[model samples]
Target: MTATATAAVIAPAPEAAPALRDTRPLRLITCGSVDDGKSTLIGRLLWDTKAVKEDQAAALNRDSGKQNDLGLPDFALLLDGLQAEREQGITIDVAYRYFATDKRSFIVADTPGHEQYTRNMATGASTADLAVLLVDARAGILEQTRRHATIATLMGIKQFVLAINKIDLINYDKARFDELSLEFKEIALSLGVKQVTAIPVSALKGENVVYDGKASMPWYEGPTLVEVLELATVRSAQTVGFRLPVQRVSRPGESFRGYQGTVAGGAVKPGDSVVILPSGMVANVKQIVTFDLVRNAAVAGDAITLVLDRQVDVARGDMIATIDAQPQVGLAFDAQLVALQPGGIEPGKRYWLKSGSRRQRVSVQPSSLLDLKSGKWNRHDGALPMNAIGKVHLSFDEAAIFDAYELNRTTGAFILIDPDTNNTVAGGMISAKRGDLGGLNNEAERVILSLPADLADKILASGILSERRDEIDIRRTNPGRAAELLGELDS
Candidate 1:
């Protein structure tokens, strides 16, 4: 039986005590189009749960510090801290807020609802176990709804709650709810989204947000919003593998030194033999240490220090793994990407590639492009335009271990950094190597042109535009020029 089918079977229990017992926290990121109430939903969830402190609530209510034309406390204002977001009445960036009910603690990333902020939404969802997708009940599903949902699935958020918000405007009608649910279910399933639970909500009014499901809509039979979150299988989704991406080597003063980062996946126990990926160095975990305390083992969420048997040459951007499940290392990779910025990404462009803790220089060579809307792959496009997701063959300057993005998001996913500003420019899920392509191996191609001077010239000459000419002109330029230029250095 399917897990969703099993969940249906276990709906009825013998006791009235809370159905969910696990305290394993889930990270949720809210996504939708602008004015879809993404922030309001977050504020409402916090408000109804009494998670927001009394002082903060009081501060919001004060006459001197209030906002919005409605004057009824711009509930979204609680999250839209940026001056631009509040003034424009739109979310422009990703905002993180934490709250907890007795059943589950949540690290909620309230992402921007603007179409331009899809990259931010993907960034937030890249780490999320569940996505709370909001759709305005009055508007039904818009283009942004489908876009966010599709992006959510692409980022590997396995679970979803399709929140049909603004139900108050729809007269709390079951027929309208059913129609909207049916329409969204079709879209969700088409995108390979699983286990969707359509819920009617009024994030602005606090209906069926945390409690009082009895009074809002008796026709709805599912668990309340909080109940669903508390019972959802978040931990099982996260505990899939062992991935420790070294973010930094911690040597505070002379008293102690250790590795610092949130454990990405699986569990690590002291004395567990682990391997440093791309380096292949083996070491037994001497101890798992954290601020003010030490433990025998460390699981996900434990931001503790790990002491290895011997000091291997470890640093930021390296991955430590259990020897048996070490990640695959390659200099060349394929990725499906959506460009957000104005410039086009092309071959020989040196963007910072950050996977887990490891960041290295990567040169992109476009092999194909996928029209994300049609879900069709387009090979030979040679360039990815704004908001276009296409398969790209990329060559990295260094070999780093990569877990398939589907297996472990934290380790498998990566972001492209702007070499000039260091801002994350693109998000990617590491699929398979280009070996699958007929007689084309990016790794082999990179190796053949691995000369340092050749690589340098390529990096200097890649991107949408160059010092010399337009994007089209740059693509037309010969990369062989770099190899030919290397002869000058040799001479």
Candidate 2:
């Protein structure tokens, strides 16, 4: 990442993106293990791109704790802005920086590398379009590197840049670079991430980061880190449905009423029929109001006040989505989450589940834990320890609304807040909707028949009982328990 200064130049649009979007900047995050040079990598990029102002650069030089032997001031000072971080010589929080090249703009999050602050790393990764995972060349790949990469993949980031930092310390070895790149690529492939680009960088010396490192290594012919980011895919079109989690109902005057929120997924236009979630009241979109103009259409990420055809008792925390592609509404759902804080996730404890703007109480039961070392989801005891990634069952007292994370990121993601401490304990993604205990009208008339989930699914998908689907509640159970239930109910 460090080298002689050069003029910023425009880069051509990347081949991976559907179209190079100029409206929004490419958002990315830099992360890895402690002292992996995440901050230095970002700082070097910012400095090279001229994102650091003159006075700020002067201040950076003045306050740099220790200058490197290469004659450049410590670049890490640019991003490690906090006093605690400065004193400890480690990043404890996430710092975001915005910079631009002639070809594109970027929003980079410099996240903490320590295990205790993995929650902060998750928070930064939540909105990132790509992940630049820095690994010390001398250290190769560490457990924390794999952990961050796993978290980024789970957050839906497909593009990854394995920044093998401090390659200078390794004497710019080509064999070592290839070995590390292959190792990371294999790990990435196992996690279903195929868009992997490995770059050798020296953050303090500014090697193959913004400037080419051909002088040091003529054998390397790959593009610089900036070139890869300029072409990486930006727009995500994986969602088939529209989602607007209503943040508030805007009404400046009694004559006009509109629901205001940022579009979470898909696109909406006037006359589109949308169903209010939980209540399931259908209405047509009448107008889209924005500060700049009354738009005819709005897509995901647009902030607008949407007026409905008629008043249907819309309120905060309600979701407005396309009726034809409605999300799953049920009493229970399955989720995979990262246990964040030291307290971890306690089984059967009621916590506040905040998905979008809606927050409600739900009980969580851990089912399995992901073993990062082995890349497997193993059966875990009901409790999850800190930094543990586990799959869980979420039981709600009322109807729960979600789309599987694979379908819609906004509607499918959530965070669990501990009521006692009022702190976020875990960040999760909805996997699927499953049956729950007895949403039937009368418990006395209810038949508690258990069946294999696949069998129940087959019966429901057959359409023979489509009209009366709600009348017959399906609870999935193991094969042995299902057979036992069938025997007990025999005539």
Residue 188 lDDT in candidate 1: 76
329-369 in candidate 1: lDDT tens per residue? 77677676667765656666788887766778888777776
Model 2, range 303-356, lDDT digits (tens) per residue? 989999988998898899886577777777888899999999999999999999
Off by over 4 Å in 1: 1-21, 63-72, 212-218, 235-241, 247-262, 286-294, 303-316, 367-380, 436-491
**Clashes in each model (backbone N, CA, C under 3 Å)?**
4, 7
Candidate 2 colliding pairs: 1-202, 1-206, 2-205, 2-206, 2-207, 3-206, 14-231
Q: How good is model 2 by TM-score? A: 0.85
Q: Give the Cα error of residue 40 in candidate 2, in Å.
A: 0.9
- Who wins the lDDT comparison? 2
Candidate 2 residue runs with Cα over 4 Å from true position:
1-23, 436-491
